[model samples]
Target: MGISVEDEHGDEVDRIVAAWHLERPDLDTAPMSVLSRVTRLARRLDLERRAAFADQHLEPWQFDVLSSLRRAGEPYALTPGALMNELMVSSGTTTNRIDRLEREGLVVRSPSPEDRRTVLVTLTAAGRTRVDTALIALLECETRLLSPLTPEESHRLAGLLRALLLPFERPRTAGPPRG
Candidate 1:
């Protein structure tokens, strides 16, 4: 016996495509059928993330910066430039976030011993606790979102998403490479 398309379930995206096909027969909406679902899923995930972080009295940006430091292992610090690169934000924005977090006692900035001119952002004990708690909530929220998929299905979906994202993850070089 072989599986058939009928065995697959149609989602909201399928209905959307059907309507678009009826209304605009000339335009090919095949790409929308997949990308739309991804976009919608991202929106839902963002809401879930907001709720999860809120439960821990933390904002998404705070979690992002703190988690970056937390993941940096012992000492749990990084230069402001490193943080700016990691967060993909402007230097001013990074400085503001670090200042806010510092005011909240979540992190502190100390002059780097190796170079007094350079400042390092270190996560405080409070920041670690908050980030760790927020992470648990985040995982719980994500697990609920993925509950519809079996383990195998989840792995397959993750692999597909990774394949889609890989091209964007590569660093872009300026101009042609020197011989």
Candidate 2:
């Protein structure tokens, strides 16, 4: 069966529009195809996520960086390179973010005993508390958003998403783009 409006949901339309322009020369495809809708819905989900984080006084990028370390367990720390990779940003950008988080007293830098040249970025007590609170609020917001869906449906959707992500989980060589 073709993808339905209910299945697509959110901002699927905009994503389709963007893709159509990019691949139109190669194929005559409708903008509202599967990938397009998924892109648009992702955009919409991002906006909602930002608003949810905003309610906790956290920027989306801030939450991303903070949460990554928080999920690291124990001391809640990682090297700057780790943060850069997780945030998918340039080294300079990650440095800037660390600087800002440091100023806000959310994170701190300490010398790595094994490698004096490397520094570990650890979440401060305050940072951990902030992320903990933000996480609770964020989960509550998500639960409410998905309230309309039955429990079985939610579980099924999550399984479907996991299945889709499985193929991309393994490491792969970098190469030229494929159509």
Candidate 3:
């Protein structure tokens, strides 16, 4: 058997898989066909996210913090501990984010109304505006990204992704994160 020629329908990963298959014929490279596309798509999406956030003068982490508070609805405040968990950052990191956002006047730290001992991170009006605007920009970019797919195809893709993600979303004995 000979190495496969580049096919018109193939993308970069297909070329890579062909090269790898020729080099290691004994190994099955089937998973690469699916996973490589997903990985590439994720990176592209992250770029779009960064561009959208940049337009709002926000970084991804800042958007993460502000969006969490915005999603909390009226008053848009959450305890620092709650923000730490929701943002999935260490308490110290959360503090640093809050400090930076506070400095920018996008958020404020105030004594919790229910428990004065606790501090709440509240989204400032500016924070709300920035996150909301950024969110709209992101969705527009994402919609364009998915424009090639039909609505049905998009729905099926979402279902497939959810199935793939379900196990990771569950609590289990912690494993080192996947690359």
Candidate 4:
């Protein structure tokens, strides 16, 4: 079950209530029933995901790097710059993560033949096996978590989420807002 903003002493909820009171006293913040629970549940989910990864002797970031390559198919490689963008991390941070994965023999750095200055990171055979195993386990864990919901319900929920997300995915325009 998800936690609530009114959990325990309700400190977080109280702050949220106070903020609404000060900013928009006419509006009720009861919508937090869903939003607050989502926030709390997301944090818990992160911990759960990390634990799952750890069980396979992988860190969450390691899984991310390896899985990204695994998903690329074929050559199973991507540049550090591309990875930094996809992973939403700074160049230096992506480099550090890649360095750690390389040290663990999960990935290797190769010079890009097309661009001598650029490098590509590729998952090793061992990395491929480990990532595949971890992915299967992760999917199983996710499936068990969603067991309460039917497959149709899961699809509907995904559609609903994408509907809510699509507006934000579009590029923002500076012109006057359209009705």
Candidate 5:
């Protein structure tokens, strides 16, 4: 396939790839063209997220926990295990986060009604308010980031990224189970 240069000016990744190509003529750096962009975009997004949450006096981890609960619908509570799964963190980390949030009066821990032995983490009113505000700020930041792209372009980009991500999202099974 022929590579087309769309614009006159190239970004940092383009420069990096050019440098690598000049340094290692035998190596193929095609993957870096896409993955480097993704990596840099992720770093920028993390900065944006931190700034948005800071405006609401929330740390990113706090926002992660609170947002998970906020998305859980009415009552806004979940087991620590559920939170761990949603946040992709370990049990000890989730426990520590819950403890800190509880101390801040953002969340409260109570016995699960369905199972007395289990504990549920419920978002306090303050937690809900903070998470709601942070979400608005986050959306605003994200919208600004996508301002360069038209809505249609953004939609198409999202679809392409999802397609690229599908392989990682699938389970490690050989194939679909037969009934």
Candidate 6:
């Protein structure tokens, strides 16, 4: 873990691949050279995210939901169904989260003016402050995580990752709000 990935002598991934090569000489472990580092980096990023949220007393899902609402701007509101879709969670989970957030005074649930049958979940001032603080912290941590890479390297990495992941993802959609 202490080894730098850029070291010409090699890093932790090299050590792991060498061990696999020793034990299973016939199999090609070429993919591990790239993917193993990505896996380790993801674990580290998860830790960073948790640490960022810790000071704000936020769970990851809380940050996700609050951030989603914050991004909507203005009234900072969205329907429970919109939230469920955005968060990729079940209807029940969305309701439970909104209920807890309402109880905490971080958000409010009210009947939508646009539709009587639907409920709107709006972020309270407290929620905005909390989510904004958490966002700044998370970005700071993430910046440090990528400190080893130059901006050009980061951009290239992001593009490569997008290409790698696109096939496994749902088809790209225009991300505007829809009625």
Best by TM-score: 5
Candidate 3 lDDT over residue span 1-92, tens digit each: 23254776778788878888988989998898789999999999888889888889989899999999999999999998999988888999
* Regions more than 4 Å wrong, model 2: 1-31, 174-179
Q: Can you write out model 1's per-residue Cα lDDT over 66-127, one digit (the tens) per residue?
A: 99999999899999999999999999999999999999999999999899998999999999
Clashes of 5: 0
RMSD of each candidate relative to the true structure: 4.7, 5.2, 3.2, 5.0, 3.7, 5.7
Model 6 over residues 1-179: C-alpha lDDT tens digits? Answer: 33343456887898888777777879988899899999998988888899999999998889999999999998999999999999989999999998988888899988989887888899999999999999999999989988999999999999999987766565457453333
In angstroms, give how far residue 65 of model 6 lies from its true place: 0.6
- lDDT, candidate 4, 39-134, per-residue tens: 876787778778778777998888998899999887899999889977878999999999999998989999988997989999999899999988
Measured with C-alpha atoms, the lDDT of residue 136 in candidate 1 is 96
Q: lDDT tens string, model 5, 1-179?
A: 12323334788788778777777869999999999999999999999999989988999999999999999998999999999988989999999999999999999999999999999999999999999999999999999999999999999999999987877666658564333
> Candidate 4: global Cα-lDDT?
0.81
Runs in model 5 deviating more than 4 A are 1-8, 172-179
Listed per model in order, the count of residue pairs whose N, CA or C atoms clash below 3 Å is: 0, 3, 0, 0, 0, 0
Error of 3 at 46 (Å): 1.1
Superposition error at 131 for model 4 (Å): 0.9
> TM-score per candidate, in order?
0.88, 0.76, 0.89, 0.78, 0.90, 0.84
User: Whose lDDT is greatest here?
Assistant: 5
lDDT of 2 by residue, 70-111 (tens): 999988999999999878899999999999999999999999
lDDT of 1 at 70: 98
Off by more than 4 A, model 6? 1-9, 172-179
Lowest summed-lDDT stretch of 10 residues in model 2?
1-10
